[model samples]
Target: MRKYALLISLLIIISAINLNAQDDNEKQLLKQFHSITSEEMSGWLEKLCSPEFNGRLSGTPEFVASAEWVASKLKEWNIKPAGDNNSYFQWFKWPYTIINETGSLTLNLRLSDGSVIRKNYQYPNDFYPGMNSGSGEITAEVVFVGFGVTAPELNYDDYKGIDVKGKIVLMNRDVPHTDPRNPEYKKWVAYCYHQYKLENAVRHGAAGMLYVDGASANPNITYDPSIIVCGIGPQPLEDIFAGIKTTNKALIEKIRASFKPASFNTGKVMTIKANTTRVNEGRACNVIGYIEGTDPVLKNEVILIGGHLDAVGNAGRVVNGALDNGSGVVDIMGAAKALAQSEIKTKRSIAFIFIGGEEVGLIGSKVYTANPSFPVGKSVVFINLDMVGNGTGFYVSAGSSYKEYLKYFEQANAKYIHRPMRTAAPEAGEYYGRPRSDEVVFRTAGFRTMAMWTTEATKKVYYHLPGDDTDAVTIDIMEDVAKMIYLALTEMANDPEIKF
Candidate 1:
């Protein structure tokens, strides 16, 4: 019995010693993470968001300069270049179409008095051509289609019994308000995407589409290249329906209230002519650097830390994008610096990637995944930082499938950050969905991925606006986020048993 008690006491002593060692290791890591200061992060952000960068538009000289600068910083941190040809740049072509000033929209109406009236709408105010709009001219009868949604599963079809063949169809920009208690709510939400609406319009054999922005419609809709899609403001739409029996206001009210089809043919022959110049901007790069791990076996595994370095190009005025992604770039830089300088050696290699062309699409990250410098299958996890410059706390989204990886973040937040952490699955809607950021590309490639942001709502106020400059970023909030991510990366890189 005495021998048994001694054995039990020994086990307890060993457990206490192990716990003490862990506590010490955590304290050491926290101290190293705190070494990444606000000033350090802000200095990098100032340069990244500076006027010299010219908004860091992808496939432009300004964007290339930003990439080179990031590579230089990684070199300064003693991080090895992890790009093609022994350099820090993974170069790839990023082709896209840009609408030039030559684009114009004109509406012609044939009056009952045998007279024709023509009115030209100004760009960006009365109407704006879609991003994917093709250069075309169409003169056809105008048909009104409400909401432009068609769902056979819910027994709701907006295009039902409507012959829109070879005619210009006018549609409201939004889906109707759905009651959560209704059985069709889920179906309504799923089919409410702009692509579905455009597909419905094309499927109905419409020659062109003009989206009227109603109070209930989504103002910012994705463009469909299948036909010429243009956005008509409320005033322009009202003018288009001036001679028609039904008023725009009346039709909008009916559609909003009932969520039913409101289709009609105005005896107005509409003519739409649009001329757009498509410019193909060539290639952009992803800046990559790595810190080798201590353990040989685990070093084969990789942890990806990245943020997009591109912003919406200059639109008459500079869009600094300080908070949109400048903050994100600095966040990753801060993490890289913290990890590289610390004595703490992770078991797995860490790669810092500053991706380009993220504003246009997930092009940079997708290109990397398609032709990666490091084996993508060997990637253990990806941490994407974007718009982490506002709000009080952090939002960690990894989807439910990555709950095991998310626990590291939860534990880190509890121990080091002590900030509110919102754990969200990808299906939690736009907030945590695959459409959010570069993490989407990695996640789609079957790699475990996580995204961290300071706040979604607060950061969006300056998201892509011209006012998204250095002054818009909340430095203190960004500092906290940087620390949180640094700690999380350290913990994840050190853990050996974590499986994707």
Candidate 2:
């Protein structure tokens, strides 16, 4: 009887200890998740989209307003400013923008029958000038240079017989620049063709370029309008997108009905006018904030989380960026806020970076790296949230460089709520689509990074058009994602050995 009583007492003691541990863990989790609330996240989104911000396109008044709001948010958090400006704003200089005004080139065709309806390829439906392509029209022979790739190493030259010098070179998209018949050559016949076709045509004194049909047709297709994102010096995105197009059925119909394709003044000499607007002088800003850690020894080191804060302007507005980054922004914001309010005080810093100019190719992040206030090399891990805020479609988790990190995230998810997240091997994931975001620049700079995105909201729409707005975001999913990230951060921050 005495022994039995002793066993009961021991059982009671064990139960008490287990209960206390569970309570401690609960307190820690609650502490990590309460800083940034759903209510606050909504407010941030509303402020970012407010009329005062004007869509936040870089170099625009709206962009300035957006910058102020972001800075204010950080200031409110009491996070130390990282920029030299004594404020949270980090500005990068960009030059040029499209000076847009309606103008056209009249095409007068010289048919085999002798006369022509047009002299030069004109405006609107005929062709839209390239993004930042210098404005002017050209009247010259149109030579079909198939893809225009100029890889001499491949031994494939589409311009072999034609001296397109002083003429307009026309090409296809993504074809190989070199000959595919070589033992070393395989795919990309069309891609290679265009590599040097335009430049070669220019070098040969060719007036300009005309690339027809990149893929199929979609009227909803957004064109590049910003020259700043392209770069300074010379080459601009506008030049690249200018001649690119989908030889849609509409083009054929337009030609067949009003004009003849043969009337391109093909062999006939004519005049061309071209015009393009460049950004010339402008500024791009990156948004940054931080959640301070309690540990003195590890407080300086950081785990940065964020997404590109900029998008391509489409339909008079930059990329809606709803799924591409809006979702990601929310995810990170949610995580950061939760951590800030969480009771899990530990070592290591938590920085939230919302970069600008990611659409143009991670330019904002690149600028940040070039002159980072923090030791960028010490940024051991970057959790890039790109396209994640859908209604939970294909989870499409990619990035093998951080598989261990992903596993850690999944483990946290399992412990917290959801089952295993849908994921893929990096190679197989490449088959879907290999697009870029600011995270690419981070990895390129020797930082261990992984980006999270999904094709879910993408498949249903809202990828990059005006349709990509805050309305499509799923706050519940965002909350869960935030929880997963926070839990991971807590585990990583508390572990003394996790840091290299």
| TM-score for each predicted model, relative to the true structure | 0.73, 0.72
Give the TM-score (vs. native) of candidate 2: 0.72
Q: Which runs of model 1 end up more than 4 angstroms from their true locations?
A: 1-31, 98-129, 132-276, 425-436, 456-460
Error of 2 at 335 (Å): 2.0
Runs of candidate 2 with Cα error greater than 4 angstroms are: 1-18, 31-43, 46-56, 59-61, 99-129, 139-141, 158-168, 175-207, 211-276, 314-318, 391-401, 424-435, 462-464, 471-476
Superposition TM-score, candidate 1 onto the true structure? 0.73
Ten residues in a row with the worst lDDT in model 1?
Answer: 213-222
Backbone clashes in candidate 2 total 71
Scored by CA lDDT, what does every candidate get?
0.75, 0.56
**Count of clashing residue pairs in every prediction:** 1, 71
| lDDT by residue for model 1 (265-335), tens | 76556666656444466578999999998898999999888888988755434678888789888988888
lDDT score, candidate 2: 0.56
